[model samples]
Target: MSNASRFKFFKSHHVPTLTVLKAAIGDFSYAPHAHEEYAFGVTLAGRQDFFSGGQFHRSPPGNVILFNPEEVHDGHSGGERALDYLMVYAHPEQVKPLFADVLGHERGADFRSRQTLIQDAPLRQAILELTRLVTSQAGSCIDQENALYRVVERTAQLGGHVQPSQVTHRPEALLDLAREYIHAHLEADMSLDDISQAAHLSKYHFLRLFRQHFGMTPHQYVMNGRVNAARAALDQGTPLTEVALRFGFADLSHFNRRFKRIYGMTPHQYQRDIAR
Candidate 1:
């Protein structure tokens, strides 16, 4: 389907609860589009120029940008310099609890609405680490989940919210429910089309926005998650073949191939190495 035609919002399990993308470009431009849920990110290198809320914004590294759901916006690389940035896409439900927990308020109350720019060095570094962990396939599941947790918790803290957002509060309020679905079923056979449909987007548009916002495509996110899960299982001496099937891989060979590709060693070797 056409990109525009896929603009409708949806709720499904294939979408990411959180995804991060890191991009370096001489020039990049995103045409007008609106998400059914909230979008937020930080520029990490050079500058980003975008039109949001009827004004042109030039965001430099260390600046955060938060856009309300369904806000029309466009973006491009600024000036003659290249740019790099990290972005996160979340459901209102995911974010709402953070605000409620932090602010102790009823749902729908704005938590410093519009966009926010974070210039603190320590905060910037922490955000970058979350993005890195989400995109990288190297970390253990415990490490990766902790990293993701940090991202959410820190964002809540920085945004000054009182409560941790629950996955169920706004089941129909935003696209985050779809993300929760992905998190719960990460080990199963999942597809981009499946995720796109969950978000009420076509595969192409979903891929585009998913990459733009999260920094990693849905496939990469799933692979990274699987790698993390496998690491924990392997470290505990789960049988290689069983690990493969338990994580929904087709067989031991497929699992071994993927495990080696991400971890730089066979499953048995990985277990042995980790045991040392």
Candidate 2:
């Protein structure tokens, strides 16, 4: 790693599903991507710019960049200076418990941070403080949990928006069917027409509703599913080429690119690395 571009990833044992990253980027730009986790970060220096939720946004020092689960975005250093930032990713299950204390709700709610960029002093402090525990790995479980809880509360208090439970009811069942079809066919060539047919809807409406419910296009969902399933196969000591083929990746190079986008490493790296 050099000053031009560097990244360090850590898994937070305290919050089992929480992952943290500290990065400085100058030359590299991130591909448009999304995660299953609710993600937010604070710019530590320089400026960070990205597009999400239909608009471009900037996060300078002390500003928060928020992304709801599975929301697509691409990022890059905003100016001549390298971008320094700290990001934390937490799954819905990890964040839901905090909502009960923050918003008086249980884990059943769909948590969202509606704004793409938020400026809040308390939220920034909370985010930075939580990263201390994750990166340093010096805190007890209780200490780490407390720091994470504060971050979650501050985030919800400042930028949180919940998706309404009532959606177009008819679509929910149909979306599930479409999702299943996508997963089942991940090892095969899949098309919008094929998924829509499985869901019993026209292609365009199915596309719209799929994005509305899953926060990603069906194609994005398929790619993510393929990468995820391939990761699982790798875990079971499968060969990289076989894993890629089984998951329907056209070839090793294609699999490598897709895997890196999601897991931050090539399939070979992920398989060989003992630390994640």
Query: What C-alpha lDDT values do all the predictions have?
Result: 0.58, 0.79
| Model 1: lowest-lDDT 10 consecutive positions | 1-10
Q: Compare the candidates by lDDT and give the number of the best one.
A: 2
TM-score of model 1 relative to the true fold? 0.46
Worst 10 residues of 2 by lDDT: 1-10
Tens digits of per-residue lDDT for model 2, 71-138: 88888888768899988987778777787667876633566777778888888888888888887776
lDDT string, candidate 1, 1-276, tens digits: 111100111111222444443445553356454443455678866788887666778898788776665455667677656776666666565655555554556653345453444555555665666556555444666665555445555555655432233545442322454455566787778776677678776677667766555445676656656765776677567888888887877888888776654333467765654343
lDDT value, residue 157 of candidate 1: 62
lDDT of 1 at 22: 49
Off by over 4 Å in 2: 1-3, 169-173, 183-189, 208-217, 228-246, 262-276
lDDT of 2: 0.79
- The CA lDDT at 6 in model 2 is 68
lDDT, residue 154, candidate 2 = 76
